[model samples]
Target: MTSSAGFTASLGRRRAYWQAGVCLAVLLGAVYLARSHWPALESGAGRLAVADQGWLLTGAVAAAGTWAASALAQQGAVVRRLPGARLTATQFAASAANHLLPAGLGAGAVNLRFLMRCGLPPGRAAGALAVKAASGAVVRLALLALLAPVCPGLLRLPRVSPLVVAAVLTAAGLAAVLLATPWWTRCRRALAAVLADIRALHARPARAAALWGGSVAFAALHALVLIAVTRAVGLPLAPLQVALLYLAASSAAALLPTPGGLGSLDAALAFALTAAGTPGAGAASAVLGYRLLTVWLPLLPGLLVLAVLVRRKAL
Candidate 1:
């Protein structure tokens, strides 16, 4: 029995390693394709270097704000169930991992593991994660719906329309909400279960509101980051125009199965930016820079966190 168990463990480890390799290969291939537009990217970077630094700083702050909002949302979602559960560090680590690891799966797994380690039952932990994710989805869709009317040009794009975008987003949001209705109905129980596991925090209405507000702000900040990238690359486009373009590009990329949305994101962003009146080269540069800051720059820290988590037997 011992030998069989050891063999099973070794097989599992081998499978995990193989899966990681496959993910890495896919990520690398996508990245290589994204880099194929390097000449244009270089030109765009040159233009961005001459743009106002103040706006860029604001963009950076907005990104950080998004991170904070995400953490707050996680905290709020789990508060009722895990009253003392503090997920700030776990949130950061998970976000970092999501950005670093291919396909965003790592972050979700890490979050689940984090909750389990914190002593929440599997069902409740899963429910909390579901709620947090649902909240984020609703917030993003809500913002998109609100902004759709203001950006009719986005609707005119090939294979898309404002009404269609709105409908799709609304449907997704509704589906998520409906799927979570059971959990929401049991909110009191869920909250109590979560609260029983931790003792350092308390659930509050204000915190929940803040979490939602932060999520909205994060979505806006993400839009602003794209705008900053465009300006930095010296793209000739209004901030609002850039923001809309960024939103569309990002939305499309998120739907794709590619790791980190690599090729899809770059291509979509560059195309959308150019359509929005920026030069193709300049748009490509801005998109590249945006990826650099939001994706590549955070990879090292994410890997470090993953390593630590592994060493501690938490991952």
Candidate 2:
């Protein structure tokens, strides 16, 4: 029995290795396909390099702030149930996994696992994750709503009409309702029963406020990062226009199931940049640079964190 169990474990490890190898191959192939537009990316990078160093610094700060805000939001979601869980560590691991693992689901899974490992009940963990997801959706929707009125100018190059904008917003609203209603219905009785339990351990309202505010700030900063890259590469789009395009493309990419939305994000951003009036070459460069900061930069740290967690038997 012991030998059979060992063999089974070995086979499982080998299968995991094979799967990882396949994922890596797919990722490389996608990057190669993306590289066909390298000329544009090069020009954009050159343009950005020629810009004032201030823009680069500002972009870095903005990116960092965005991550910090997101960490706080995650921390707030679980605070009520897992009071003893280390929020900072949880955020780091979760964010790292979100970026490094294939499919965005990895981060959420890691978060739930972490909470469970720390002794939180499954129901509470699920509830916290649901709340966190809902809060994030609310923040994104609010930003989209705020930006909806001015979308005409942003979509001017693409000639996206006001009717289209309205339709998109209406769809988003419907989707949100659909997603929430079923969950609410299923959990209604449980929620009612646990109301006192939940209320007794309420998360800090101030933390929640900060989390939402920070989410908006992070979204704004993300746009600014792209704008800075555009300036660096000498692309000609206004800040607001760039922000609107960024938001639209990013929101669309989030729907994709690819690891970190890899290929989808690049393609979407490039298209959005073109729609915002940038030439193909410049748009490609901005996308590459943005990926550099957002994806590649975090990869090393993510791997390091994963290694540490594994060593500690925490992953």
Per model, state how many residue pairs clash.
9, 6
All candidates: TM-score: 0.70, 0.71
lDDT of 1 by residue, 199-288 (tens): 222246665675577567666778888777766656677777776677677777776544566666777887787676766677767876
RMSD of each: 7.6, 7.5
Report the Cα lDDT for candidate 2.
0.69
Candidate 2 structure, TM-score to reference: 0.71
- C-alpha displacement of 53 in model 2, angstroms? 3.2
Residue-wise C-alpha lDDT for candidate 2, range 1-315, written one tens digit per residue: 999889879978996676567567666766786687677667766765566567666666666566666666655665543433344455556666776565556777777877677777887776666656666667767777787687666654457899999999999999788668855575676666345333433456765665566567667878888887767666777777778788878788776555776776778888888876778877877887677666677677766775676577564
- Predicted model with the maximum TM-score: 2
Q: Cα miss at 183, model 2 (Å)?
A: 12
Model 2 alpha-carbon drift over 4 Å, by segment: 1-36, 45-51, 79-86, 156-204, 310-315
Give the Cα error of residue 207 in candidate 1, in Å.
5.4
State each model's CA lDDT, in order: 0.68, 0.69
Model 1: number of clashes?
A: 9
